[model samples]
Target: MALFGLFRRKPHERLGFELYGAAVRAARQPVFFTELAVPDTLDGRFDLIGLQVALLIRRLHRDPDPRGPGIAQAVFDAMFADMDFNLREMGVGDMSIARRVKNMWEAFHGRAQAYEAPLQSGDGAALAEALARNVWRGALPADAAQPRRLAALALATDTSLAAQPLDALLRGEARFPALEEAPHDRDAGA
Candidate 1:
């Protein structure tokens, strides 16, 4: 049984891995660093990926499809698994990795809560403030445009996710709006 288990992954787990990869690809968009000014540091990267995952999870939660909850759990499991791998690669000791992962989970949940209300409300300023506080870690750029741009992207992402069918999302085929198509002004509205 153990050997068979090693060879066969649950379908949801496979889907989760695929979804995580999609989130990573979305987070790596060069526009985030070049135009949005999201820092290219480890935390910065994680935050972006986390945001993508959170948006997916949020959409799943609202979906009435029977598979929605299972897919959501799978995506969450994939995220923590990736966190574990990253921690080990960063040379964190096994004993400390668990604690660090726990902290990261807490942080991720906090961020989700922070962004959820504003995103749902379609309030651009509120979303910008949330992104500024969470993603930028309170070190908002002097120009103010960067956070606004990020907020616009977040709004677009939310809309894009909402447009995807639950079945497609459960199949790990998530899509986000192109950065070039992201809104540029607060008036653009979520």
Candidate 2:
């Protein structure tokens, strides 16, 4: 028996990789940096990506389907794999890459957990404050409105993802809200 077989990834893993791609694209929207004033640094980019992925994971976990948790795990695995590749591309030493990736994983998990409470309670202000702390990285901006806008985006994403069909999500068709309009207005046709 072969210890490692060809095409080993289960179907959910492939769907997860595709879903991660969708999250990355959603996170890369220029409006986040230009209009919302999210810092354009690498850390800023990662923060946005984390937020988007966390939303997807949240949606997956809420599903009644039993495969939801497994799919979420696959999405997370795909994320770390991409991050490892990025680190390698940046010329990080092999000896330290694992450590750095671990740190990033912790940060992502921490922020995701922190954001969930406010989202569950439907407290926009709490969510905005959480965003300010994480996105701003402790140097709170003079313009409080920026983080609030980010929080709005996050909330809109939650609503948008919730509205998406579970089957669509399973097919890796998760769609973020349009930057040009509120989520409720955009999903009104659905």
Candidate 3:
């Protein structure tokens, strides 16, 4: 029992996990599926969750606090841990789990980087193209409207996350906005 206690997570790690959970819930919101037409498949869910987490990581890396980077890392660890668990739950062979997860990590990293510049520069078209290429997973569409909407949502989501205080984020509380009305003020309640 004491040995198990010795392995317990620190308070901050717990907060990291709580924050990750919030991201997961926000990603699962129905607007992405029903309105934005994000496929509700397993891969789609994974991408949405990954995108949400990436946004948080972006904000955390920019955070002034010394603990920000560590919290971002903890959230990342929790995300991959959930992925591994989900793969096992689906009965992926033990021998293949590591390889599959590595592939997922690579994919996620690539997508995250693809999003970084567009997000930083606030280039909606570039972000839309990236989202279309990744989310649609096929040839570029003739009409870019589909992914354009998603890009708008992503930008709005980022704005909402940015409005929240670092202290609120450190405490594992986040308030993602509604699909239509976003951009609330900083003092808004979670």
- Judging by lDDT against the true structure, name the best candidate: 1
Per-residue lDDT over 1-190 for candidate 1, one digit per residue giving the tens place of the 0 to 100 score: 7888888865599888888788889989998898877889988998999989998888878888877778888889999999999899999999999899999999999999999998989887887888888778889942388778777888888889989997787667999776778878555462
- Residues 112-175 of candidate 3: C-alpha lDDT, one tens digit per residue: 9999988888766777788878887744461355577667767777777888898999889987
Tell me model 2's lDDT, rounded to 2 decimals. Answer: 0.83
Q: What is the TM-score of each candidate against the true structure?
A: 0.91, 0.90, 0.87
Clashing pairs in 1: none
Question: lDDT per model, in order?
Answer: 0.84, 0.83, 0.80
What is the full ranking by lDDT, best candidate first? 1, 2, 3
TM-score of 2: 0.90
Superposed on all Cα atoms, the candidates' RMSDs to the truth, in angstroms, are: 2.3, 3.9, 5.1
Q: Which stretches of candidate 1 lie over 4 Å from their true place?
A: 1-11, 141-143
Model 3 CA lDDT for position 8: 91
Off by over 4 Å in 2: 5-7, 141-143, 183-190
